[model samples]
Target: MKFQVRCFNIILLVLLLILIYFFFYHLRYIDDDGEPIGTVYITETRGRLDKSILTDYVKDKEDEYFSAANISVPILVWWTPFTYDTGSYTRCNNNNQARCFISNIRKYRDNKQFSAFLFYGTSFRLYDLPLPRHDHEQWSLIHEESPKNNYAFSFESIMNMFNHTATFKRHSDLPLTTQWLASIDDLLDQTYLIDVKEKTQLQTTENLAPIIYIQSDCSTPSDRDLYVKELMKYIQVDSYGGCLHNKDLPENLRNPVETMEHDEILKLVSKYKFTLAFENAICTDYITEKFWRPLKVGTVPIVYGSDQFQDFLPDNHSAISMLDFTTPELLARFIHELNVNDTMYDSYRHFKLYQIISNDTLLARTMSERKWGIHNDRVRGNFIHQFECLVCERIHKTRQDPTIKYQAKFDDYGCPPPTTFDKNGEKLERSGNWYRSYEFTRCQLEVFHELLDQKNYSFTEKDINNAATKRFAPSFRRNEFLR
Candidate 1:
């Protein structure tokens, strides 16, 4: 009887202890059962909370925000370009997603829960993050520019931090594959079409060179100037602009940076038969106006940029590619042959003059299928506004159903490191590559961790300098990439 009584007391004590553990664990997580989604009591583990996150969190929240899985409206805050909304930001359909947009990060009169924090990848820096991440909040990336903007984005751990992305890759949450070109017509412009007969006459008279090579920024990752220098050995190249300037521009057009969009420059360049469309960095889907401008003004482009550049053009024969030749000499020989042969030259222009394209060209179909405009017609608004709606709709969908995961992958914005050429024709690492990228990121990530640990997003440049006095991690110290 004594043994039975002792067993009953032991079982009762076990039950009491189990109940006590759960009661304190429940207190650890401040529930928002009757408050706005972001409103919560701070946990002691995350260190001292940002006082602002506590005060302004649920400042203007309505009763509808309380205790609901499906948020009718989720606010998205832009991390960069604070205290402003202009251009495309003004034009949005709120009725569609029933969502809100906040240009500033902290202050909002209509303070709904901030479901996603958007970062413009080019403008975003290591010190520019919005910190003290909430359990319910997610991160979104709004950058369509090249990975040259921030090389650290190439790292898998950094990219996975973004829950969604509006990037150039076709698979991103919002694919802005060719946002630079407003429409298909941008590719089909024949405004400056010069007859082959006049073109050849101009070349012979030394009035217009056979090819035009204009680039201001020199010593680039592609080493464009180096290739152009080698190509000049065989062909007649009228080099203008800042790098390898062998000719003079008209007085007004001398400033290469400012003269980029001038009408006079376009008219002058159109007279040339071929344009050197060399990109600063070669990347996938990184085609810019360099390739587009030559095509726009009815000049043949010698494309030396993206590997899959033909996939974005009118036809396979639309442009002369650097990929076909072993060296610059071989490529220049092909150019010289085409320059002398009128029939061959005219053949390249046939598709443009006829206004007909092959069925396989994805350029037209992709442009027509896009939901947003390039500020060309304003039919559906610009890409910036469309990206906002994408975030808004995602927030609503994810809250409505928990199974949908918001994720952005490395391929969405990852760019391979830039390669430089030595005098020996061997590939060398430039400071813009993994060496600098890894070391710089190590320092930046230290500050990032400090920001998260202390809940201080406003860590200044001075703070970063002080914190990063110790450079290079022990794990990465022996790695050649960080050397």
Candidate 2:
């Protein structure tokens, strides 16, 4: 009886040892709920809070896709100066001691487990600190809103947060690119086309006496002052802003910066037949609110910035392009004709029928269709939220594929200087004397002679093109393209 009892005790001891081994194995390799785990560390930089908010947002997004069978969740931890000492900060249940561990940035720098390093373009100067050596498996995040020439980074991919599409520059050599442009979704919802149509019909019937221009910038690289002055000759233009102050607005509306924010500006614009929508500087795909506001208010926008303005319009007739005419006089004449002819004017408002879609919808459709390779469509979005979501998604994708790598040469992509095109849709050389050098092309000379004929001023095209350099008063330069 004593021998049998000792044998039973030994058998129980063996079973206890087996249980101990299995428990330790599971503790080391498995997460809560016995699922395998992966972790990604985001750096704590100037935009750390925004990044954290985005991380939580992505978590909420993931929860929407969660399933009962698959409880896998990627651990997103913050890597700050404190993280270097205490490791990473992760939430832990009071009962699960084995599942919690402090993560350190220094340890992770040498360890290949960290997923990505997000670098904001504006904070590029802070990169002197120690960071992980360039790793093929990890992602390097860089985003820029403007081509400010101050950006410095060695990135594998780029997120362009400009107000234009990723294909705005059309550089084939650019690295893997993502776009996060300005979102007009909220703005579109606030605007009502029904009221705009009513206002437009009333104005057409009443025949407003003067066109309106609200400009504040007295100086600009785009020669807007000269163009506006020349346009004023063919028709009366009531200048409201500081550039050519013929009329003073109320004290509350005197500041362009403040007035532009409210709908009061659009309200004032709706009373007019046309509004000048000229950009301060001509950049590829750099259309801003100046162009969009007039359209929202049912006033025809005389646009003069991006050569690709037609692409953003709901229809070709939605806005008039400054490039369509050879001279400002011709454009002015066209606007006059449209103002007098109500039917012709009403045709421009046809786009009011279709409601504008959010930037998110446009982007998803563009990506699904793989249409980023072409400039066929306008791309805009809620720049902040969409950009953060995109970054998070890319990081998750890289975690799944450890072999992924990207490296783009900086010279392969850039914002080149804007190109000048004549009315015939041909590029022109920037260098040469203005009216006096006969450097103008045959097409330009023909347009010049036609303008002169309209004014009943006879001048041989060859003589005018090759006329000697002559100085004119600043006012004359503003009121006339050539004198």
State each model's CA lDDT, in order: 0.68, 0.47
lDDT of 1: 0.68
Q: Which stretches of candidate 2 lie over 4 Å from their true place?
A: 1-133, 136-210, 353-382, 406-413, 418-483
Number of the top-ranking candidate, with lDDT as the measure:
1
Model 1 quality (TM-score):
0.75
Compare the candidates by TM-score and give the number of the best one.
1
RMSD of 2: 19.4
lDDT of 1 by residue, 1-483 (tens): 999999999999999999998865444233224222332321211233354553454455454433332323465766654223311122146455445433433433124455777777876776656555666777888777666566667666678788988887766788787776776765566777778888888887866778998888885667777778877877879988888888888899987656665788888777888999988877777787788777777788999877788888877677988767767778888988998898898787776776656667777777878888763444676666677777777777888898888777988777676665544323456433444554566577666776767877777767785666556444355555532
Over the stretch 153-249, how does candidate 2's per-residue lDDT look in tens digits? 2121222211111122323222122232222342244353444345556555754444778898765545476677777777778788998778777
